[model samples]
Target: MRRESPHAGPLRALFRQFSAFAGVGLVAAVAHYGALIGLVEGAGASPVPATLAGYVLGGVVSYALNRRYAFDSDRPHREATWRFATVAGVGFVLTGLFMGLFNGRLGLPYLPAQVLTTGVVLLWSFSANRFWTFRP
Candidate 1:
């Protein structure tokens, strides 16, 4: 049998976790953008409020999925939920700021601004959740 590298197992595990995280994030993004679009287009709601609502829905979906799949933490639901909400709360503020800057101040389209904001928030979520919210 061939010898495997010492670092391979941990690397593979990390990759798997990241893949799961990304998958969950994709689902969350669908929820977020769907609500945003529906509220803004169908209900004629303003972008900021619509985005906030969408983020809340998406944050719920993300917390459930990430806790179960991505991080696979055995932490109690109460603790994990509180930690996840804290991170998400900060993320929401950042999202609003970025969206306001990109869409409102910069005069970019809402869709593009939201897309950019999502990317930025994705990084923040992954880092914060990995380090604090779902720490192993």
Candidate 2:
């Protein structure tokens, strides 16, 4: 029988965790977009503010789903909630900056700019949640 490499186990586990995280992200993204569209198209809200609200909704969904499904975190709610919120607060700042840059400065449509912002925030959220917030 062949022996497995030590790194292989860790890398595979990381991949699995990331995959689960992405799955949860999809659900959160829906909540984000729904709020975005509803506020922007329905209520005539500005793109930046609309996205800010949507981001909050998405963050709520992300926290709940990611804790139970993606990271399967056992960190007590008191600790985990703060850590998750910290990570999300940073993500929120990033989201606003990117939105301002892409949609406001560059004049990209709101949806497209948001897509780009989401990509950048996704990497940060996954890393922080996996290593800091959810780490056992």
Candidate 3:
């Protein structure tokens, strides 16, 4: 039998972790999007405030699920919460910047712009949280 690459195990583990994180993020996204739509369409709320509310809701879900499931992090609440918040704050800014560049400047449609922004933010969030917030 051929020998396995030295990096294969670590790379596989990282991919598994990323898969778990994405699952948690998908749940959070559904929560965020549902709340956003409800607030904007049902309650006649403006997009900004509704978006903020939805983001906060999603963040809460993300933190709880990620702590227990995604990273299996054992960091105390005080430490992890603040780190996650910092990462998320930066993520929000990145989202806006990406959206501006993709949609405002490039004139792409809203949905496609949001999709691109989401991909960028997903990478940023995963990297930051993996290295900083949930680092062992």
Best by TM-score: 2
Q: What is the lDDT of residue 109 in candidate 3?
A: 62
Q: What's each prediction's clash count?
A: 0, 0, 0
Residue 80, model 3: Cα distance from true site in angstroms: 0.7
Error of 2 at 16 (Å): 0.8
TM match of model 3 to true structure: 0.85
Residue pair clashes in candidate 1: none
- Assess every candidate by TM-score: 0.92, 0.94, 0.85
RMSD of each: 1.7, 1.5, 2.1
Shift in Å, residue 101, candidate 3 = 4.0
Query: Where does the lowest 10-residue lDDT sum fall in candidate 1?
Result: 127-136
Candidate 3 stretches with Cα past 4 Å from truth are: 44-49, 103-109
Where is the poorest 10-residue window by lDDT in model 3?
46-55
CA error at residue 76 for candidate 3, angstroms = 1.1
Give one digit per residue, the lDDT tens place, for model 2 in 52-88: 8999999999999999988898999999999999999
lDDT of 1 at 121: 94
Residues 67-88 of candidate 3 have per-residue lDDT tens digits of: 8888999899899999999999
Ranking by TM-score: 2, 1, 3
How big is the positional error of residue 25 in model 3, measured in Å on the Cα after superposition? 0.7
Candidate 1: residue 20 lDDT (0-100): 92
